[model samples]
Target: MSKADVVAGIPGAIGGVPDGMASGVLAGVSPVHGLYASMAGRFFGGVGTSTQLMVVTTTSASALAVGSTLTDVDPDQRSGAIVLLTLIAGAMMIVAAVLRLGKYTRFVSHSVMTGFLLGISFNILFGQLPSLLGAPVRGSTAVAKALHVVLHPLDFDWRAAVVGLLAVALLLGLAHTRLRTVAALFALLVPMVVVLVLGWTNIGTVADTGDIPTGIPLPHLPELSSLSVPLVAGALAVTLIVLVQGAGVAESAPNPGGARSSVDRDFTAQGIGNIFAGLFRGMPVGGSVGQTAINQSSGARGRWGGMWSGIWILVILVALAGVVGRVPLPTLAAILMVAAARSIDPDRLVAIWSSGAISRTALVVTFVATLLLPVTAAVGVGVGLSLLLQLNQEAIDLKVVRLRVHGDQLVEAKAPTALSDNEIVILDVYGSLFYAGARTLQAKLPDPDGAHDPVVILRLRGRTSVSATFLHVLGDYARRLDALGGRLYLSGVDPRIRDVWTDDLLHAQGIHIEFFAATSTLGESTLAAYADAEVRVHREQRP
Candidate 1:
């Protein structure tokens, strides 16, 4: 809100324009739409988000998802379809915020994010190769396009390549200097001037995409007559990509004042931004880690920096349209390539690869899917991989330990090699009993074999609910004990779990089942169950 905040934002705004332009090209929309998205997102998102420095703008991942989704639409109708898709994705984000689903973002594990981002980085690099080389490389996937560029190097325009390489060199070389914040601006402008001075009319520039529009467009509803099931699915996919990437931004860019930011609030803010952006025929926008980082490092004091960033972009569009129009496409592509390279972390990928087989496989599969499949489908693959990894970890962590009362203290002990007649065994269950964990527990349960009427006691303390799968397992175990002329004692059973059992059904099946409260001490529960076993043994032997 201060002058300093506004001043800090100027650099970020200048840097963000080329980024937005690059992403717009990636999304197959006018570069100006990217500027519109960035402007709307920063202004509205700054007003609504909890974080002071987080900037919402066009991102490679969301742009790619949007582009892939609109591929089937006719060229004339693609812009309208993109607008509708943005609106739908924004609506979904708002619904998610209302439902308080922001906490669910934590379920997207680190490995999955690593793979997803690596894939996006590669996508951006390969997707821009043709523009960088000034060649018309066409293909469906990043790999295919990359292969095309590699095979047809003869078609590349040397002048455009020189411009792109110069831009890249300046951008990277200036980072170590004091003017690092404005590196992108210099990188873009220097190339534009060189191309203009050299009379390189053959090079493709932003002007080639049609005249640059000044100021914002009026809000209009997109036509929905051409909407399809695939479009809706693509919107959902974009929503997911935005949320995941937004969460990363929120975590990476903390508020300057040290106040905690709410992920749900940020989610709603992004939703509002997207809605306005779509209304103006802009690409979908979300929390951007790169731009927000730049905003913070440039001394952004509050949300005003983000708001000012949008204001500055608007001012440029209105007053400097001619200057922006002359910017070379190869220069923008080179800047994006540098940005994409920065997104990937070789150390993190290596750590994930060395973590374990499951982590390695999940990372590899998600990365490969992102390269080979559409962006939307790649997101699906990442989510599926994360779920499988979670289940596998849970199954491994599930434990069942044996306990014994040594004098006055309860002590952990190994399971007995064999049980005497009417001897009772007390086992404590730990971890989850849901889904795969339940199956794992069932499989790992010790057999009641080689025992004479051995009574088994299971201690399930602190569990609030019993899953149906777990209940089935218990039923099967009870039948096994009943066959051995022994009873099953479920000690420390919460009332909720005990409710799952029916006395009449147990009696009809002649299954001996006993329940005990978890409130009792473990030693007390085990001793009481042991006393009952002794009494039963004496009564049976009396004959």
Candidate 2:
């Protein structure tokens, strides 16, 4: 590795310390789990990812997702549940990669995703309030706990709040200076030193929650007993979150060498990383946006930058395992709070809000769902929103344009509102013909009533597939036209579409109509269908 790669890895590794531990707190587990994830993800993920500089690590979103996944498990079973959840999510991700399902992540609605992410950021900020203030509160949800903390300011422990707020201030201040690379480290260190000097035994430490293990993480078998339907569903949600975030990281941090990264390869890389993290008794890990930015900005020269990051984390773990436990909980909370604040993108939110009611509704609903519901349910809501947006677009986008054969060049115009007697109309369709789109097209088609002996030819060029709904719409339209002494003809139909259409009951109904398969030359099928229509019209008009 070059000196540049080695140097770049240092900053990322240093930054990973506080972020990893804080992420562990976020996941409602031992801070060391996040530490383990940091090391394991970088070690496994960095080796195989197509994006060489991409650092897979403990991200806040993935941590919160882990917490939500194990919310219902018994306290004693949580450790095993964490491992099982991570393993299931990893397995699912590898399956997705094997099936070449990476490209479809792009279809996720931008507005919905933005809303979900923003909501998660806010949730993180709110959830950390109790720890940040060192206040005891009772509430079922993050929002409620935050509200209780807010309403009962007198209950706050001023000492813990000062420590947390001091860390926050230092983080914000150093962010503008050249020392921003190590600001988080100082944020944790300064507060711990102050608390130690003051002898504030009341302030909770990382050790208060659990024992801090020394040395490198080792592999452990997952508790197969913890596996359940709920765990499987939650794992699916975790998989969705990681894959989507991985796609986003790729977009933000492109390869410096102008090499295009394979999405599926990166997906598989994350899967392997998570699998290793789980085996090593770590929290869930993924392509972290913050750490990837850190690696890139540090001038990472190659894949080794990321690989060395894992090594650096291991070095720090061995050296400072004792000091790490002495770190204050409030300081960790402060680090997470600052991260949450920086994560919000107001400009994007405003842009989505200004787009239209459809966009605004998606953004608002997703944001609300994320706040009020569990993380897995929020993810489901976001997915449902995406499907709704897709169906809405398909229905709105479908259009029927009239195409007239003028000598050699076909002329385009608005389709007729109603077909006329002894007339031939050629219509070309645009947009999807599936589900709601087919229904929309059926509604927009020209009425065949009072149009005797009329012939309408629909050009289906370039369409290799059709939904069953499309066939039903066609059957109904054909029956209408035939009942009015008219006929509907399909031109340029693909052989595959013909096969399906021929097998359905709609084919029997289509007997009154005719369909012509596509040919090598463009418009050949339509032209032939049109000529036949003219002959049929003339024959019908003959006394």
Candidate 3:
């Protein structure tokens, strides 16, 4: 929003281009398209959408899905699809704005988001192999295609190859230096000067950028019918992932500037940018944390910084469209390689891999899924796998310790609080109870055998959100208690927990809910509810 924010956003935006293009290449489309969309979409959205310190650009997941489905095998088809998806994704953003679901991006968790980002980083490196070595990228499998490129490096254009390699070296050098912001420009410039001085080295030139219409593209609505159902579904997944990534950073950004990013507004901004880009058959866009940080670092002074960058791009595109052709593709690839290399966090990856069997499995599954499938699909798969593995672990860790009233004090049912005519049994809970926690509830709860009536009180103060599965399990436990001539008393549910536990979907299946106060340092309201329940139960059993 401020000049400082815009300045910081620029370098990150520029750095993101290669990643975006690499995604396009993976999707079997022109890499150049990614660059253009990122440049324009970011500038306009950065300035026009909101005063938030963020950038909009082509995302890896979105590009991959659009490239795979819309592009088809034909380059033209692929290009068309990229253009179409860019517009479609943009339209979706606009719809989000109109509907005001801007805050919906808040629900994604850090664990899932980290998994998506780390998984994509690996895939980006794999995607770049063909261009890095000068081979024609082919094949559906990432590993096989990467190997093919490596094994047949000689088949690539040598002149282009040499320049690309040099670019990589230059970018790496600059990135580690005090002048990383201008790294890409210098990388491109070096190749341009060499070609001009030596006179066009038989190597393919970027002059083939072809003719992009000189007039600015008019805004238009998306053609939803033309894009297939799979493509839309894939787009939705990518949209959610990108929004997750964007919101994650904004929510966590140090509030030093006293201006935190609004997830819903950012989403609307992205949607608006997409519409603009889509109208022009450009790339789909989303908020970029990298770019937002760069803008801050670069000394930008408000929303104007983004506006100025957009203005700068328009001027450059209009005046120097021809110059784009002379730029070397390899040089661009080299810059990208450097960024990708920097993005991988070996320390973090190792920690995730070695944490435990479930974590290790999640890491492996995410890695494998990222390489084998489209990024959007990969995200969905990784999320599903992570949830499954997490749930399995929760089920094993849960121990529904049964406590019962012995005289005036409650104690473990095994000895001090053993079941008696005058005793009431309580199942104390301590863990999450979401989709991943359902199995624990099922396993820890005892089966009712109707011989002795034991009162069951469930304490859910520490538990998180409740899923349908968990509610059903709890319902069954309650019913069993009822059958055994006992009562079910639920306590220690905070307002947040109460809201989740009482959802219509679960309530429709017969789950009578209760609430209580939280007993923590922060002072929760659930504790009072628990006290009230205890009093009611004690009164009912009085002689």
Candidate 4:
């Protein structure tokens, strides 16, 4: 296992350099910050991460988020702002873990995430076009800037274009070969060497972005006075992006030990990683899908693979820090463009398009928002899309079925649209009865407006609790039935409901709802309630 960790760590470390620098470039920060994040995140986040082989590191999504966050800040102050943002986002993650909010990540919806990721990819691709083309362009968004470069090709430096294209060609060429593991390094080295040897001084290089320190940076504190409303909000956005992406990473690579990974614990692990990253003067980091794939493919069996990769990356950074500054900006741009291109999964996009109207809407809206809006704003839009989808699903999921006793067995059928006089109707509710679900039930249930003396027996057998909205729906139904001398009976209900305020609340709402406790035998309580309803109907008829 130790040997496997060491073996896996090597490839991960090797990829971390270019990958890390690319993330930093994405974040609009110094490339070294990405390296620092790679080291801190892998070491600190992996220490107690639930997903053993999941490599916590700087991710494109988070990097884009950081770029959007500091878009307005002065360049000289971005470093401090980035550090502060990382720490704040990390703290937020820890709070989420403590509050056990990880389970809600599923509610984000696959369609929303897919759209957001697609948006991030396109944003990266379009944003890097200017750098890749070495074209002087200015625009508010990536798409806008790329358009300027395309609309006016005269602004492009042909020399830089050639180098960038060469790197891209190399990436595509080496993708399928045995050297694919180190393809990025090869691409970087080849194009950079060509430019260096030819003395293509016109090509933009890493030195133009920011200064890269020669050794590991010392821990530093963020500027407390710089905290503001926008900064906090940006931190919140970063927190959402990382946690959600981390959840996907955990799902992508299941733990090899057969143990289910705890999402909350993973959240805390990422929090620890970001804290260390900030303290060490690094950028924000999170669970990276590409890096995790490298870890697994390289034979990592446990957390040690990620931890060792951190050490290896640090060693590399210290050894080759000076050379990194000489790497052409166009090469890094090409690497990022290729990576982002691959990140957009066409199959998933096609599936989302075919899923249904609701899913398609989510995907399209989120995707567009990602391209047009700032990274933080796009995140908010994604979250809004997820919530809307969840509510919509709840509405669609609710079902009302009628149950009839045919001899000793109960047969299920579609619920009636209206009830008849002197009738006994048994309804079984399926799916959630909260919020939109309960409102959907209101529409699906039979109309009591025209019915006289119609007894409604609702089976709530496994229900342990009821939402206020559902309770209100029940009260309204009971009141309508009571007006016609009919009664609403609840049978096979969980015992706890009887002791809760729900029982008293029903009476307080001016309706007497008969409650039947569930029995060991299935449908026994319902049958008993039915028998009592029969007696009441028969007595009314005789009178």
Candidate 5:
């Protein structure tokens, strides 16, 4: 790595240390695990990732998810469970990569993601409230914990609260000044010094939780004896959270030279990072939006910046393990609270509300579901809501417009209030023809009454696929027309659809359905169908 890369990595490494430490607390693991996770993720993930600026590290969402998953495990067994879960999640990510499921990330609609992030933000704030107030609040959900603190305020430790509040103030206040780069560090350090100088015995430090290992953790496999369904489920949840969050980071942090990054490659990179992190007994990691942004703004030119950031973190872990132990828990809690608060975007919520009722409902349902349910369950709810939203939109947008040949041009024509004997109608079907949309098209079609042997020509040039429901509708319409001694012509049929449509089956039913090539112009197909309709009318008139 060049000198410039090292310089650029300094800010990222500095910011990552505290952020990772905070994530560990969120994950209900030792703070040093967070540091190890960041280091392992950056080095391993950076080497494999397509996006040079992306910094893979511990994220708040994954951390909270881990904590929720392992809440019931024995304290001593929790660390091992965490490692096993991370490994499982990493394996899932690798499977997703090999299956090339990255394109499915597009299905995660903006409203759903917005709602999820909002829910996670709330979780973080409420989840960290106990630490922020230095209260021994015990509950499963963030709301329950907050309620516990409120109901028993006397249990709060004033010294720890002071440290947390001061850290928050410093972090928020210094962000507006020139010291913003080092603001988090200062916020942590100043509060620690105050607690130490004043001899605040009631305040808990990192050492209170567990000893900080002086060197890198040796690679080892977590015990598989205690593995259970819940652990596997949690790993699946973590994998999804990582993929979604990583996609966001990849999208937001563009390469300096403007080359597009491959989402699947990045997915594989994060999987590799998680595997190493698990082996090192570190927390699960993904592409961190905050850290990546810092790396970019710090003028990082290539992947080496992220690689060096991991190296610097390793140095810190070895040289400053003793100092890290002395850092107060509330200070870290304060940092996390501020970061969580920043993640919640009220403006985005308002935008979702104003977009439309369907979109607004999706946002609200996902948000509420995420708040009330575990992160894993909430993902299912969000995906279901997204599907419903898509169906609703297709149902509303499906249309069948009448077309007429006016001189050399084929233009849209208003459907006549009534049809005349021997008249032919041409219709253009638009939008998706799947499920509910097909029903909408069937209902919107003009009636064949008042016309003797009337023929209907449907233009379907752009559609690539047809559902069974749509085919059934077409068959029913063709039979109705056939009974009237008329015919139905499908003009401009896409080859792909025609291949799947089984034309022989419909012809065997005496429906008299004729299909025009997709390459045929709409005017040519309509003229051909019109001539055939004229021939049918003449035949019907013969006596």
Candidate 6:
């Protein structure tokens, strides 16, 4: 590597190493696993991914979830399960790539992203509250622990806590001001210096970072005998949520020197990283948005930035392993808190809330899910709620109107008065015809107990395709219309959908087809039909 590459990569790798180790500790795993994953995963992903600055680490959300799920399992079982899930998730990603499932990742809307990140910010912030107060490292969830410490801070080491708090303040100040790239190191070191120099409060203090193992992690079979179905399900959910979040980070981030990223290439890189991580008994790896932003802001030039960092981390660990163990936990928490604070995007949250009720609802759902549910389950719940809200919105958008006869003309009570109660009644479709949306159309039809109007007109300018259930329902409606002394009229259909209708049995029922252009003649055809029907009505009245 070039001199610049060495300089940039060393710091990046060092920064990544601590975070990864801490994350593993936080997730109730051995620190070595975190190191192995960071070293190997970063190299693989960095080389393969399009975003040169992108880094992968254990996320607070995923860590919390993994901790919760694995905390109850026996040690052997937990290790086995983690390995199993890691491999499974890696396999799933490969399958997704093969099947071109990348499109699904795009479906996670802006609201979900904003809500998820905001929730994470809160999680990280709340998690650090006890540490800032000099409380013991305890509690499963952030809020619970914060409350516990607040209600009763036991044997609080005021001096050490002060050092940690100061460190956090410095880091935050540096980040908010001009000097953000070196914030992590400053955040870690300042507290160390304060504690070591003054010998303040005999709390454990680090002289330097600890030695790193020289060799790579040994491969061992992860025990799977104790793995339950629900555990596997939760792991799968975690993997999916991580993938979704990672893809967003990859797609949205600028590459080295402020360039765009190729999402596919990024995914390929992440896949490679995870595969290596699995081999090394490490958990799954994905892109870290905060880390990427930090690297970009730090003036990293190319992939060498990450590669150099990896090498530097290994060297530093070998040299400073003993010193690293002396590092205070409070200081680490403080640094994490500062990093979390920087990630808070209040404006994005406001935008999501302002978009509309549906988006607002999705945000609320996701935010609440993250707070209330276990980490792994939270993703599933949030995504489920978001999708459910979308479906409900589509349902509301889908509509059906009754077209009735008035002396030899059909008319519908839709906007723009497409038909003049003369030729046909237009049921204007404004949304998708998915499973949930199909109900709205079914409800708007005339009751079977009464004599229905003849020649029902279905203005299909907006409908793109029909599901099996939707097709079946429409077929039923068409059959009913035919039996009720009426015929179905289809207009304003795009050729793509028209082709399906032509081949489908639903179109076999007696119906009239009109090439009403949605941009033009759809309204004209309805108006002309209504006008002709009005003339017929007048003639019948005269007789």
TM-score for each model: 0.92, 0.96, 0.80, 0.98, 0.93, 0.80
Candidate 2 weakest ten by summed lDDT: 503-512
Model 3, C-alpha of 314: deviation from truth (Å): 1.6
For model 4, residues 1-543, the per-residue Cα lDDT tens digits are 498898889889988889989988898888888989999999999998999888999999999999998888888888888889999999999999999999999989899899999999999999999999899869999999999998998998999999999999999999999988888888788988999899999898888888778876678888876577788888999899899999999999999878999999999999999999999988888999999999999889899999999989998888988788888988889989999999988898899899999989999999899999998999999998888878888899898999998875779998999989989999998988989999999998888888778899999999898888887888889899999989999999897877774655666779679888999999999999999999988887885
Off by over 4 Å in 3: 1-32, 47-51, 71-73, 94-115, 215-226, 251-256, 393-421, 434-439, 446-451, 460-475, 491-543
The TM-score obtained by model 6 is 0.80
Residue 348, candidate 4: how far off, in angstroms? Answer: 1.1
lDDT per residue (tens digit) for residues 1-543 in model 1: 899888987988998889888888888777877888888888887889987788988998899888888777887677778888888999999999999999989888788878888988898899889888888878988878888999999988999999999999999999899888889999889999998898999998787775687665568888897588988899999999999889888889877668898989989999999998888778899999889988888888889898899989888788888888889999888988899999888899889889998888888888889888988899998888888888888798898777776665657777554456767678876778887888987777768776668777887778878777777787788888778777788877778876766787666755668877666564566666656766876776675
> Per-residue lDDT for 1-543 in model 3, tens only?
555554555566455544554444555555556656666677667655444556677665555555545534355455565566666566676676677775655433334555666656665566666666567878666577777787876677766677778788788778778878777777877977877787756655554433434444444554544567766765676566666665655654433457665666777777777766666556777766655566557666666555555555555556655565576666656655566567677787777667776666666667677777776677778667655655676666666666554554556654222334424455676566766567666665655554355555676655556677776777887666666555566665666766665558445865454445456632233334435556755775677
- For candidate 1, the 10 contiguous residues with the lowest summed lDDT are 415-424
Pick by lDDT: 2 or 3, better one:
2
Q: Which candidate's TM-score is highest? A: 4
Ranking by TM-score: 4, 2, 5, 1, 6, 3
Candidate 6 structure quality by residue, lDDT tens digits, 355-378: 888888778877777766666667
lDDT of 5 by residue, 1-543 (tens): 678879988888888899999998998888878988998999988998888889999999899888888888898888888889988998899999999999988777789878887888888888888999999979878888888998999999888889999999999999888888788889879998998899997788888889888876578878897599998999988998899889989889888788999889989999999999988888899999888888887778899899889989998888888989999999899989899998877888788889997778778888888788888788778877777777777789987778887766678977654445666788887788898888887888767665667778888877788899988888888887777777788987778887887668667765568887666454776667666766877888899
Off by over 4 Å in 6: 1-7, 50-53, 75-84, 137-140, 176-179, 193-226, 254-265, 301-304, 399-422, 444-453, 459-464, 492-543
Better of 1 and 5 by lDDT: 5
Backbone N/Cα/C clashes per model: 1, 0, 35, 0, 0, 24
User: Please, what's the RMSD in Å of model 3?
Assistant: 5.1
- Superposition TM-score, candidate 5 onto the true structure: 0.93
- Root-mean-square deviation of each candidate, in angstroms? 2.6, 1.7, 5.1, 1.3, 2.3, 5.3
Candidate 2, superposed: residue stretches over 4 Å from native: 503-512, 519-521
Clash pairs detected, candidate 4: none
